[model samples]
Target: MIGQISEASPEAPYLAANLYLDPAVISALLIEMSDMREPPLDTGFRISKADPELLDVWRRLIGLLDRPDEVPVMAHHFEHELMFRLLQGPQGALLRQIAGTDSRLSNVRRAMRWIREHFAEHLSIEVMATIAGMSVSVFHRHFKAVTSLAPLQYQKHVRLTEARRRLVSEHDAAATVGFSVGYESASQFSREYKRLFGASPRRDADMVQTIVDPGP
Candidate 1:
């Protein structure tokens, strides 16, 4: 997102950029998708092939990135068109769940958000279930179905992922970072860390450092 200029493509080398799209646009799209009552559309997990029309529309939107002065006025309009196209596409129903208050997916999403904010805290499945407004058994099933992880397993994953980021970038002590992320025992942290990342934290950190800071 920063820097003078960079190109991304599917050709020789690929580059990726993080785009922070306006949440308001996504919310509006979700609402539009969910409100349709005529026989629901087939909501595929992903679109296997690109639609020519949508692809052209996307190209037009991406063109605006080169025109900084016009982006403020033109971005919202482009986003609206893109949202409409998505609502008419195969993933429409999947996108609708993102904005639905009554949907079980929405409830699970709320719980996921809470877990992210308090990943280092002692998490209770019962408490998470209460947050999602479902009984423990029901919430557990739906949550696992949605995320492919049990609640505590999800927390451990989040904790370890965060620990890896801090360890790689900040060179924090493995034991200290482990406790900071919520594990009480350093040995437990090391065991889980190795299991997930395939290396001790120290080794992983060194490997990352070598990749990012290779010097003459």
Candidate 2:
């Protein structure tokens, strides 16, 4: 099962919901979906105008959340249908372009992947450009186009997300986690972390833990 709910407008507090269901199980459906061939173009999935039918389906799906255990199942179905519709829609051109070519967008994606996988180490635009098979200037242009963030900014986001995750699971100090994520200066790490998350590491960690394991 899958669904979506939309507020009346950007500022509305209440939402109208819709739901959808398919006979196939989510995992099996995903496998079959992965096997389907795609067109060779740069169309990304986008919904230009809202569809009432789709909105109705999404509302019904939201009704199923009364059972928490079924949330994952419903979410999978919702994503599958949403993606399918988007791919079949007009904006799918951007998606197709990225999918079909060894274009700059592809290079940006490659660089992003490498940065995510190796964020614990020092990152240089030169090294990233080499991985993307482009000159530094070209790489920067493409990277900015695809992500709207510079390489270093993207790296900081990755590092911060990872550091926050680690802070929740590991018993290490904030400085230790900062250094492990490639920051040599603890104070710099603290400052950046606060800037991004709007709170210091220790405070952020406490909030995350409270959310993860709440008390009565």
Please list the C-alpha lDDT of all candidates, in the order they appear: 0.77, 0.70
What lDDT tens digits, residue by residue, belong to model 2 across residues 41-107? 2222234775775555566567667777887777776656654554455644454445444755666
Extract clashing residue pairs from model 1. Answer: none
TM-score, every prediction: 0.81, 0.64
CA displacement after TM-score superposition, residue 116 of candidate 1 (Å)? 0.8
Could you report the Cα RMSD, in angstroms, for every candidate shown? 4.8, 8.3
Candidate achieving the largest TM-score: 1
Q: Which stretches of candidate 1 lie over 4 Å from their true place?
A: 1-14, 17-47
In candidate 2, where is summed lDDT lowest over 10 consecutive residues? 19-28
